[model samples]
Target chain A: MGKTMSEKIFERKVNHAVQPGDLVIAPIDCAMGQDGTTPLAIKSFLDMNAQSVFDHHKIFFVIDHNAPSPMESVSRLHDEMRSFAQKFGISLFDVGQGVCHELMVAKGLVVPGDLVVGADSHTCTYGALGAFATGIGSTELAVAMISGKLWFKVPETIRINLHGTLQEGVFAKDVILFIASQLKADGANYKAIEFHGPVIDRLEMDERFTISNMAVEMGAKAGLMVPDDKTFSWVKKRSKRDFESVFPDPNARYCEVVDLDCSFLTPQVALPHRVDTVKSVEELDEIPIQEAFIGTCTNGRIRDLEVATRILSGRKVHPHVRLIVAPASREIFLHALQMGWVEEIVQAGGVFVTPGCGPCVGTHQGIPGDGWNVISTANRNFKGRMGNASAFIYLASPATVAASAIEGKITDPRKYLR
Target chain B: MSWRGYAHKFGDDINTDYIISGKHKFKTLDMNELAKHVMEDIDPNFYQKIKPGDFIVAGKNFGCGSSREQAPRALLAAGIRGVLALSFARIFFRNAINCGLLVLECNTSPIQNGDEMEIDLLVGKIYDHTQGVQIEARPLPQVMIDILQEGGLVNYFKKYGSFRGV
Candidate 1:
């Protein structure tokens, strides 16, 4: 049988042909732990009585989730992380560096065909570059740090072929939300999801990252797209790292095949408390929103900011709603600033937060109040996710969020777009 | 590999956010302190109610959302014996196992709250002493069982030096 993309990645890691269900301790190309999970990993690594990290250069520690050290306690964690990084000579990204997933790709730390692991679930975002990446626990990260290898049960691949073209108003966020609606939260549990077909070819690098970033919402181990000319060219601008393009064979065995037609898709939103509870933007009741956020590893790229800016340039945000804009990384932040997107966003009454996780993780900066309603472009809408259990969070595309911020309600982006 | 405890039953989609609220995140690294606030948002009395050596039985998608290892570590610190659910998110499953916490998959609806339950890891059987019934659960693979036997991956690594099987 022909090998799936996941199988191909694993085969290279193990240095042998492997099939689904095979458990192998494969060498990892990169290992990461963000601020929220790194402290624990450091403790575990010490608890294991390890003398030093297996590969100092290959491991990364990012301080993005609670950057600026929201509190003294969080600052202490950062202090410990700094100490750990210094002692082992590992790369450490301090506050304002941006989210780890974004920084990893922006810095060209992750290349195609690499097996990457992180302590944060959204680490799967790296797969947008065709890398086989997944999230594990802090303890597992500790083990990988010590040995540079960990065990993985090679998962069966599920083919999700996206056909047709996305309408102007429908963003990559909408496409992922629609897919999650069909797959439910646990639909792809323990499986590798591979996106193919013509629609994928048209998606930009940032758009591809947005889709792969949410694949974990449906329980996918990894979400990947084949690296084509666009990928090569975009990555070329960032780094000259030599990476072999990996793709699935034509006859690859698939556990299931799901075909998504992008032509009929509309702007989508996920309601309160569950990502899978998705609906078309027009079908929702007229809900008033108190806050609108536009940033995260999912939709915090320059392209996403441009979309929000393009819609908000000539309009002012409703006086009742607070719009917060966060860039994914320092590089993206500067890029957006230079391109005048930040000026347009601010003129529209959008509050620009630091280039870190910020409200996306509920750490600080623009947390919602009791019983308040929020429209955000970030992934996940679980209860109390924004630091208030009584508050409601709605997930939508950046365009939709920008439009709703202007109307003070859940307004569809298509209505405001030119 | 066997465990016996009272059932602490919960409903479906009991996400990691509810297991240990984000409010507590980065507040402290002490798992014991974290255990004191486990499930504080969902059930305010959860920490006070749960005793050491208790088992959590829940519906589908237990420990879903956010790949925080604290979710599993908090339970372990609180002395939870194991978790039995219809299913689990992939990351949580790995986290729980890495923490030396037992996670089994089975239809947990029939397991009532406060029921005395015993699980035989070797036999893949769950015996409800309170209900006088037995449910067959999918057994863990040998690799997982061995890891649990070694008291999680850290200990396993300590004992064996490096992981086997490339």
Candidate 2:
């Protein structure tokens, strides 16, 4: 009853505690920017008479959506962003070292218990590190850029406790997709989610990120994880900058706590129209996949590729299916190369693309033609979220996607897991 | 918070991109400049010019994408006095109040454009400002009404910083 993770987080880095009906100004620990929205945010800041950023140290920018390939206008936008960062002294992640959320995790920009606001909705991904991170509009982002403060309504939180070990071949993506299917997109409307359980301890940083990344698909403001050894070690290694550990008080009370027997979860996928339209791979009959893309902030990680490579070692993509593999980051790309997963993916008659937000935003690469049925590794499969509004994007775990890519349809990943 | 403008009606699920496209997401570009082309993507003539004091009626998830405070900034600047939606996207709802834009969440959907609305923002009612037009919408919670009355969350904080750590 005293404090939840949300209250505790606000209590620390903020100027004060967050009570009902109380509006407080808190210093933003990290401000994330991406190419699609950051340029406009910076432009608005300039228009508002902000000569320089209030504090560059707290600001961060990344060019994730259109990286590795800079179309003319896109290149200009990047240049504009570079100039904005230079003018305001904000550190820019131009190389797009990784997906913005993954990059923030890897770069140590987000620490457990830090309050982060990102121009992109997925900024809520940092809540995986135990921070109260939320997404904001570019206009509000600009305000945060100049004022270092914004207002928030303390969202009602629903706590999910994962109690058992995960089934093999079922990674964090499946766990989240299953959760979304249960909650339905609007079930948790205007709520914050705190994910806790024993299984969370085993998930890698990127895996935890994948869980928190898709939280927005459930209509949640953010998804949070409590600080653990993973949080401490991650902050120490990446941030190289010192950070304090924050947690919910021992007697904290949650509005509701939903317990899960993760061992009960299998490879899951969201059909169409909503992330909540969940169906297990085995439940569907003869569902042929037109395409399979394995990457995004959701499942684009070293482990994801490693699991996929094992499944695709000697197999070729179905003659009718086009399979695309994108590493989550340059670091992951280089790591994949060294580990031979890159070669495995290529030898399987699949296309391995660059490390950016391509298929996810339907921008750079992997464009889905109309009526295309794509089982993707990205977050949302909302109507028209991909290429054509009519294109049916089904969200799934990397393993399920890999198995389906081989079978040319949605197949249960358990066939290959053992 | 003084309610001055007339009402404009629009259905919900009005995304930020719909409010202002990604390409046009720059600040200091006031609402009048933005409202000029409001819904140009959806309806090319929406913002050529609009009535004052009109409200936007949204179906569900109004202001759903990009947490940029600009969506409401442009709407409020353009001509909208308040937004009445069956539901509101969480972030946008916060930003609207924080930035002093009025957003009212009303249940009972299917808001038609022709239904003229009279909104009592203080009381959280959206009666047909138009005579002979009857529409249904749920009023807001009292706590939300109070926050709005103080001219947005920040102003409320300024007057009573007690609820938050100041």
Candidate 3:
């Protein structure tokens, strides 16, 4: 049996040996709740008649989706969440802390080889740090708050080994998008994807996060990267808090493995209805779109901003295109403004929205009407996800999305990588 | 948010966006408009077929994504009696219980889809008429039972808070 990093982490958490099919209950080290669900969870916790939260420090309640978007409806939701937080004295990040995924990693809430759970499906996003993270319901989160334990089946591990460095204009998002497109939306359900290869080794923490963040999009349990200097340096900067680090032993077992040679890889996109319905940019042309959005927890990092700015350096978005760029958080937004990436986008006539899940959740702040086709950096281009079921969504890398936003058609980022 | 119903069964990792969806995270211009979409995503015509007061028996990790209370709220609106699963997502479980939706956990469900279950939530047990199974849930605290019996936290607060809600 070739134990992958995930299996090892699971073993440590449960304090027992585990196989792919074995069921195990492990204590969730960190529990993250976003505002969309926090108020309700807090209400439930309060309703439970518990004197106080199970543990104060273990819960991270963040208001990410509607932060700074003071629509009448948005404000109501925030007000409710705020009331709950104030009542409970829970760890809350309300003031433009950024998307919970990136924010948690940057703030040192996640530790390698830890079992983390969240109220959001994207809670699996923390897997980038090699933590076993998965999404749970608010009910489970409530239980986790009170009980601090989570139940999960020991999932089969899929070993993905990549060879060759990414070509110019291609980044981690593209790589992950391609992987999801190949695996299909439900490809790796209840499975752990152990990412290996020199390509991953060279990836920066943010890039690894971009990939691991979307592992759940493939219906995966988690994605893990072996701890290296990048992981070590990233951790060192965050905390001196000491916890044991985990690594897979040499003779660990794996249920399956696949290899990809990235030397020939290029820009790819997943058309609607399914994330795995992939097509290369080279094959798509003149697919005119009404809207282009370049931001989401998946692709709204500072690096994503740099890629978009690079693509729009000397060109303006097409006249027919309505483009919106929402940074992921206040830090990213302010940093981009300080770095002038936001200006480059604005100068190109793109509307730069605030850092919440503005357009991604279809809150209608950036919604498109009937007959619209949108290209976004967010995941889940499902039908009717973005306010219009008739409308089409095309998912692409930040560079590809930026390039397409400029041209109002599907285009490769490498074509404008200069 | 208080509920009295029979339990129905389901599988694990029941995601919220999958249950109700992020689009319906808040009160909508049209409430019933989302019912069909919710059913379509989970089970088409689920709203119509699911009997009132039937407990939902599910596997583990139920309600696995987004803290969207709308999922359970939708379930309550759709006339689910209660949720019975091996486990629940943190928020969904709490929200359902808060919103007067009865959510119970049994080690395993002997009741199947059409089981005539009579659940005495106050007693924390479900009498499965069809399967002759009587499953006991991990009982909630007495105060919680009062909160549920009062039709949710709001009603409880309204009665207890001296009209602070007003």
Candidate 4:
């Protein structure tokens, strides 16, 4: 049988062929943990009575969540992370550096054909570069850090073919949301999804990152895209290391194949508390929002900011709504600043915060008040995701969030786009 | 091995945030302290109601959001013996196994809140004492059983010096 991309990647690691449902131990090329989970991982590393990490350069610790220390307790955790990283000489991305997954890709730590693991669920974001990345628990991270290897139960691949061009005002976020609504929350549990066809080919690397990042939201082990020139160009600009890309054979067997036509797709929004509860922008009643946020590992790239800035260029944020813009990384923030996207957004009444996770993880930065409704471009809208259980969060594209901020309600972005 | 517990039933897509709210994730990493507020968002009296050896029974996609280990750690600290669900999020399943928390994939429809239940790991059976029905669950792999026997991955590592059995 022809091998899928996942099987091919594992075969290279194990020096033997692997099939779905096969359990094998493979060496990890890169591993990462953020402040929220790294402290626990550090504790587990110590509890294991391990002396030192297998490789200092391969492991990374980032302090993006609760950056700048929301309180003394969080500050203590950050300090613990710093001390641990320093003692082991592991790479540490301190506060204001950006989200871990973004840094890993932007800094050249992850490349095609690498088996990357992170303590955060969105670590699957690196799959945009053809790397097989997945999230694990802190203890697993500790184990990987100490031993430099982890076991995996090879997941069957699900091929999704996207054929049509996206409609105006729709984006990669909308495409993924539409897929999520069809698949539901656990539709792809423990399975690898390979995105193919024209729509995926036309998408930029940043947009591909957004799609792969939300793969875990549907319970996928990894969301992989075949690396092409766009991927090579992006990785080449950022990474000095050579990498070999993996591709699925045309005759490879898939557990399931799904075809989606993006031509008729509209602006999609995931309602409060459930990512799968999606609706097109026009289908919803006028729901007022108190906050509109445009940032996170999911949609905080330069392209996302450009969309937000274009929509808000000659408009002002509604007096009642607060618009917060946070870049995924300091590099993106600097780039946005140089391009005047930051100043234009600010002039339009949007607030700029440090380039970190922002209020996406509910750690700090812009936690919504009680009963407030927030329209955000970040992934995951589970209850209490924004630091207030009573506050409602609606997940949408950056364009939708920008238009919503201007209207102080859930407004269709097409009108603003036109 | 056998376990007896009362089921605390939940619905589909019970995310990790509902298990242990994000508001409390950074408040403290102390599992015991976090356990006090476990499932409080879903049921305010959950912490007070659940006794040691109780089990959380839910429909599809339990523990679905965020890869935070605290979600499982909080449950383990709150004396939850195991979780019986129709399915689980991938990361949460691994996290539970690493934390030595028992998670079984079975038909949780027959299990209700306050129902007395018994699970036999060896036979992969769930006996609902309240309903007087037996549900067969998918048996866990021997490697997972070995890890659970050691009380989690950390213990497994300490005992074997590597991920040998796994």
Per-candidate DockQ values are: 0.74, 0.25, 0.15, 0.81
User: TM per model?
Assistant: 0.98, 0.86, 0.79, 0.99
- Cα-based lDDT at residue A19, candidate 3: 83
Better of 1 and 2 by DockQ: 1
Winner on TM-score (1 vs 2)? 1
Q: Give the per-residue lDDT of model 2 (tens digit) for A94-186.
A: 654778887888877888778899988888888988888888866567778777876666777788888898877788988898888777665
* Candidate that would win on DockQ: 4
DockQ of 1: 0.74
Q: What C-alpha lDDT, on a 0 to 100 scale, does residue A377 get in candidate 1?
A: 92
What is the alpha-carbon RMSD of candidate 3 to the true structure? 7.3
Which is the leading candidate under lDDT? Answer: 4
By TM-score, the candidates rank as 4, 1, 2, 3
Q: Native-contact fraction for each model? A: 0.71, 0.23, 0.21, 0.81
lDDT of each: 0.90, 0.74, 0.73, 0.92
Error of 4 at B78 (Å): 0.9
Superior by lDDT: candidate 2 or candidate 3? 2
Write the residue-wise lDDT of candidate 4 on A127-194 in tens digits: 98999999999999999999999999999999999989998889999999999998889989999999
State interface RMSD in Å for all models.
1.3, 5.4, 8.6, 1.1
* Evaluation by TM-score, superior candidate among 2 and 3: 2
- Sorted by DockQ (best first), the order is 4, 1, 2, 3
Q: After superposition, how far is residue A83 of candidate 3 from its true place, in Å?
A: 3.0
B57-134 per-residue lDDT for model 3 (tens digits): 777667644446667667767777677877665446656766687777776557676667776776777677777877
User: Against the correct fold, how does model 4 do in TM-score?
Assistant: 0.99
